[model samples]
Target chain A: MKAEAFLQCSQCKKILFSVEFEQLLRVCPHCGHHHRLLAKQRITATFDPESFEELDKEISSLDPLEFPDYEEKLEAAQAKNGATDSVISGWAKLDGMKVSAAVADFSFMGGSMGSVAGEKITRTLERAADAHCPAIIFCASGGARMQEGLLSLMQMAKTTAAVQRCRENGVPYISVFTDPTMAGVLASYASIADIILAEPGALIGFAGARVSKQAGVSKAPSDFQTAEWVLQNGMIDKIVHRREMRTTLTNLVKMLSWRLVKHG
Target chain B: MAKTWKEWERPLIEVEENIEKLKQKAKASPEAEREDLLKRVAEFERRRDNYIEVMYSRLGPWEKVLVARADQRPYTLDYINSIFTNFTELEGDRRFGADHAIIGGPAYLDGEPVMVIGHQKGRNITERQYRNFAMAKPEGYRKAIRLMEMADRFGLPLISFVDTPAADPSVESESRGISEAIAASMLKMFELEVPSVSIVIGEGGSGGAIGIACASSVLMLEHAIYSVIPPEGCAAILWRMPDKGAQAATALKLTAAWAKEFGLIDEIVAEPKGGAHRDAIEAAGLAKEAIVRHLKLLKKKSGSKLKQERYEKFRKMGRFLSENPVDALAKTR
Candidate 1:
């Protein structure tokens, strides 16, 4: 695979090769800006080729509240992202080691978590537990989807319990944060990972920095609420740039897989 | 940095000093100048009182922010320990290590067994660092979920005191599944058959606060604030400037009074003259009485009944009905 075939940073506008970018772990070598990745691209980058077997792809969203233009928004987001919901979940091999993975698509309503996203994530965790595979989630969201009202908010609880069940089953759950994780989603399961990782510069928090400011809190420090801030506060295990994500995940999967095999 | 009084306090201090100087001069100097000095002293005193009154009465949203963040105010853990007896803290998520930001344990409320949970903020810089500024990591919520489930199992009512600005948003928290922890806590709280009550003692900013707040009844301190997002967040999104948080607060309707008017809160617990910090014991006493009364009443009801009532309470909130006969009848008819 050619390393230079990947997307460029939106801000720095640098075109990057997929292989080269993957080696750099999705970070722009010249600008150091983190670039967004599609769920499919993320899967390919992390897993051995042709190793992905997706689950819960058939499930669709229900507009229970009859929120105005919600159907249209969902349709547009699905078409733009080529996914049934804001998230994609499946089983794949990281350096030939089996693992379950779920990635949220920011293109879909700012990757806001809704009922479908939560259910899909829950199912993925369950599947990983049943298969005895470690579960990995790449979270990118703007928190709960307001269009779904409280139901969206309720997903936080549902997913958290699911992850708990996974832990009880001795399945290791790792959460990887991308840019702009916030609100209900941040408050819930994202914070509970056995191992937490983030892309450099990801805005990860329960509330955005602006909301904190609006609430009369001082402006977050220049590095406030970013992955670095989270690291400083001991909230995350590490901040891995995009380009290093593949190798990092591969190494982590190899270690966990060895443990699982030995235990079995 | 600690030597200087704040800008607002400087004027008051100066006026007070001037008043003292005038009184000393009036006693030592001749009668003619003494009268003038007395008049000047009276004027300064009047100005000082007026300034204090005006400042207290018409605090801007930004000023309210300073008040909420004031370290002198009592945090959730302090109140929990003071009011509730025999709090045996439960630790860990059973899957991961425990989080220090959230404190939960079994306790008795007026001789009745209850679960007490709260966000504990550190008093000083070192403590804040230790507590992660009161923001719960994934384990905090996970720990909360475990304790809540235990309370439900043992038929104990749950009382939560909220004060954190939000959940920890660090990369480690995200990796550990912060969202999942919060979500699980929310789901568990809602489904629990046991009675649950919550009080907002400080900034109930977002899901971090709400995760443990899905209760049968909710109370807020007079000056505490709760909202979907903090004002600064709204400001950044709406005005493109993070500093426009004051405008965002006005629009978000986060104040306790606003929440009560909006029916988001069941009742507002009155604070002391200056605020809760002015009288921590009194404030805690008031909060304890309210909790005891509500818990006592709720204890008589079955878990299913409590759950139903809680569900209905949240469902009925924010709903509006016109008083005009035709408009009121239109929906029912």
Candidate 2:
């Protein structure tokens, strides 16, 4: 990388050498803000080398609503992100231990859950429940995909019902909240996990802050929806840092899977 | 009494006002002209009814949204009063405070005991404030979970009416973990051993709607609108143009017709001509019939079988193309 190339920390607004920033996995050295990672970056950061096996890679959405410009939008998102949809679904090993995994990337259409994204998430959990393996999902969504409309709304039920499969089978399901997990996704599989973890400083809530104001609720403090603030309020189990996220997931899944085996 | 309606309803209103004028003219005419005037009144009345039937059946997606949100539309409490007997109103989630947005309790369905629950929108401004305009907080969803669990325990058939613009999106709701509260409600409805029926009686908004709507049979009224977000919200977020709500509504395919066509809902309960608001009694009667019919079919299955069937119903919903096999991944380059 060129030494002259620089990146600014979005949170702290401090100039940093791009190579140094990349070395920290895009975590700001000045303010410790963890930059949102692409889905592929999250996959590589968390999973064991060569152990991730993608699932439902060919699954993509259909414009059943014949939504104007939707097809073109989908094409652009695909080309921009080098992926087919907002979510990257598959199974990967955490520190050599297998778990069903699905990582949502915000770069792809704001990580909205449309039919394909919902189908993939549901399939991942179903696979985990069927195989008696632990499942983990990294959630980073704005909400349901408004483009897909009611079909997207139904995914709330579809995915939550999939989570029930895990509950009934006594399988462990974990969800990690990345930056900006809210609305439909948070209200579904993301919140139903056996253990809920969030990255430090991630925005995790059911609704956005602007909506709070629109609804005439008292204005919230700046730290209102932050993971640390929510941790104090008891919405999630832990606020793990980016560097510690893998180890935390590995530890939690190991114990949760062990409990399942003992129950058997 | 006079009724209020949006601009989209002008066609029906014109026909209705004409019928009213013709009836008045018949009363004022002399006996010889009275007979002919009465006949014209009768003819106009028929035309008005027909107009309502056709217009409602052919309403655009955005027009459906307007009707669903119309102040005159019959709400859950109205349906409860008209359809059920021996009604009781329960309150509070017991974990947090009570949310007035959702009202529920054990009620007599015909002569049998059953649980009835729904999002209760306000009929007046003051009441709307108390009801939070039908938007639910974590407490409301929690209260619903309690009602659902009780219904399951008692082996009573559970009925839910979904109506809202989505869950309460506020700091208090977030502080109380509104997301998990709603998710728990969905999980509870999905796993219940007793037969359950959910009707989208009005505006079936996003997570708030789906939370209590995962039932054995999911139905939507003919005029109700269900979507991931309200048309306004969708437009503002997706297009950055708030005035494009009608366009968003069309693109969203939020109408009951679309829901039924996509097989997302079990059936479309017919509202009285115009809407459920126009003829509450007749609309409630039709809803009662649909409920009774579904209960008869659902009541025959054993508990575990019914539960499993409910689970599988939601498990199969989606529209996407899967060109590769699930297990062919690891070996593929």
**Going through the candidates in order, what is the number of backbone clashes in each?**
61, 0
Report the C-alpha lDDT of model 2 over A194-257, residue by residue, as the tens digit.
8999998999878778887566467787788899888989989998888888888888888878
TM-score (0 to 1) for chain B of model 2: 0.91
Candidate 2: tens digits of C-alpha lDDT, residues B1-333: 012246767777777788788778888989999999888888878877887788777878778888899988899999999899988999978987989999999999988999999999998899999999999999999999999999998988999999898888878888889899999999998889999999999999989999999989998999899888877877887789877888888888898988987778999999887789899999999999999999999999999999889877776676776666652331131
Candidate 1 per-residue lDDT, tens place, B4-28, comes to 1144346656877878988898899
Lowest lDDT sum, 10 consecutive residues, model 1 chain B, at B1-10
**Segments in model 2 whose C-alpha atoms lie over 4 Å from true places:** A1-5, A260-264, B1-4, B10-40, B325-333
Query: How many backbone clashes are present in model 1?
Result: 61
What are the candidates' interface root-mean-square deviations?
9.4, 1.3
Tell how far residue A221 is off in model 1, in angstroms. Answer: 21
TM-score, structure 1 vs. true: 0.58
Q: Name the fnat for model 1.
A: 0.15
TM-score of chain A of each: 0.90, 0.95
